[model samples]
Target chain A: AQTVTQSQPEMSVQEAETVTLSCTYDTSENNYYLFWYKQPPSRQMILVIRQEAYKQQNATENRFSVNFQKAAKSFSLKISDSQLGDTAMYFCAFNMNRDDKIIFGKGTRLHILP
Target chain B: NAGVTQTPKFRILKIGQSMTLQCTQDMNHNYMYWYRQDPGMGLKLIYYSVGAGITDKGEVPNGYNVSRSTTEDFPLRLELAAPSQTSVYFCASRPRQGDYGYTFGSGTRLTVV
Candidate 1:
């Protein structure tokens, strides 16, 4: 069985500050993928970033980046220069390279305070 | 382009009633999925399809049915709505069978009384 865990249920940081959301997963498969998704109040799931287990280099998109440690089975999301719009529920996700299912973590409610 | 579209943004069903949650994708994706999101429970896969006419049960498929008659459409049917079925439902699609590039639709909030 595969599972993703987001340790933090909620977090708050001042705008322009950097915040990191922690995530860890338990999976026996060596080949897999990790993803971070953002769900705003509108109930839309937006893909923030993704990383391949085989890739040693972390994935970065604008102010969003992932620290993917395959051996530790840890994948975390860091939001730099966070803005008010960055406030939302962030979820860490996992999927096997060959499997059709994508598992998701509980989620961390992030608040960017001005 | 409309990445993924789910109809009936909100619905309320009485116990024992039945309804279909519609989902469609214009991206010509080969894969589609239906999942339910509960508070503090990320998302549970209810049903998924590899392509048109190819549907399968997922992690939590009980009390739910699905059909994919066309590549672009995957609708989930609830035979008998129950209080436990109240939650937000999401539809997603991707172009390939691989686990990446999933586009999610704005979820439908369903409440069964």
Candidate 2:
């Protein structure tokens, strides 16, 4: 079974500053996918970024980027130049090789301080 | 595209009551999933369907049942609700190809009293 773990319960970053949410997963399979999802107070879950296990280069999307360390089974999400809209509950997820099942970590409550 | 939509934004049901949460997608996606979210805990998959006639159980499907009669709709049924079943449910869909991320519905908040 694959399990994702987010150690940070809460994180805060000043506006325009950067913050990173830590995530780790346990998986024996080499082929997998890691994802970061954001849920605002509106309660909609949105995909932030995704990293393929085989890809060495981390995934980056605008202000959202990921630090994926396959050897350590660590995949962290970095938010650069944080904005008020970035304040939300961030979750880390893992999926194995086209598997329909995606396991999510507990979650990290992110607060973008203005 | 109303990608995915879940009906009954919020509901309160007494224990042992039965109700169905409706989900529909406009994306014509082949895969649809049902997940439950508890406070502080992330979403956990309850049931999923690969296509109209194919369904499967996920991490937590003991108390929930699902049916996929059409490609666009996948409804979840709670035969006899329990207090532990109180949680926010989300419906999501993903195309078999050409997309990586799953399109998720807003969610259905259900409380069992």
Candidate 3:
């Protein structure tokens, strides 16, 4: 079984600063996908970024980027120029190449201090 | 598009009671999923369907039942609700592509007293 782990339970970053949420996973498959999803107070799950295991380049979406170290099985999300609206519970997810089932980490509660 | 929609946004059930959490999607996605999110805990996959007729278990599949009769609907049934089952349930759907992401429903907040 594959499991995603987010070590940080809570994280805070001041406006205009940067913060990184760490994630690690255990899987035997070589072809898989990694994702970061955000859940705000609205309780809506939104995709932040994603990285394919076969790709060497990290995935970046505006202020969000992933530091995907395939060899280390580490996928971390970095939020730059944080805003108040960025405060949310962030989750790391995993999906296999041939399956649609997604496994999620516990989550990291992010607070953007203004 | 309506994306994925879940009914009974909030519900309260007592022990030994039963209820069905309705989930429907308009995107015509071939893959659908059900997950439960406990307070401060990450989402746990309960069940998932590859298409209209194929269903499979996920990370946590106990105490739950699901059926996928069509591509747009996948409802989860709880026969004997328990306090341990109290959590926010979310439904999500995704395209068949490996690079595509999932579209999640607003979620149903269930309280099992």
Q: How much does candidate 2 score in TM-score?
A: 0.94
Candidate 3, residues B1-113, lDDT tens digits: the string is 78899999999999999999999999889999999999888888899999999999987899999999999999999989999999999999998847677899999999999
* Candidate 3, superposed: residue stretches over 4 Å from native: none
* Residue A88's lDDT in candidate 3: 99
**Model 1: runs farther than 4 Å from truth?**
none
Cα displacement (Å) at residue A114, model 1? 1.5
Scored by TM-score, the top model is: 1
Worst 10 residues of 1 chain B by lDDT: B93-102
Global local distance difference test of model 1: 0.92
Q: Residues B25-110, candidate 1, lDDT per residue (tens digit)?
A: 99999889999998656888999999889999998999999999999899999999999999999999988744575899999999
Candidate 2: CAPRI quality band = medium
lDDT string for model 2 (A19-107, tens) is 99999999898888888999999989999998888899999999999999999999999999999999999999888876776778999
**TM-score for all predictions?**
0.96, 0.94, 0.94
- Cα RMSD, each candidate: 1.2, 1.7, 1.4
Candidate 1's residue-wise lDDT over A19-86, tens digit each?
99999999999888889999987879999998988899999999999998888999999999999999
- Full ranking by DockQ: 1, 3, 2
The regions of model 2 sitting more than 4 angstroms off are B97-99
**Model 2 chain B: worst 10 consecutive residues (lDDT sum):** B94-103
- Shift of residue B81 alpha carbon in model 3, Å: 1.6
Candidate that scores best on lDDT: 3
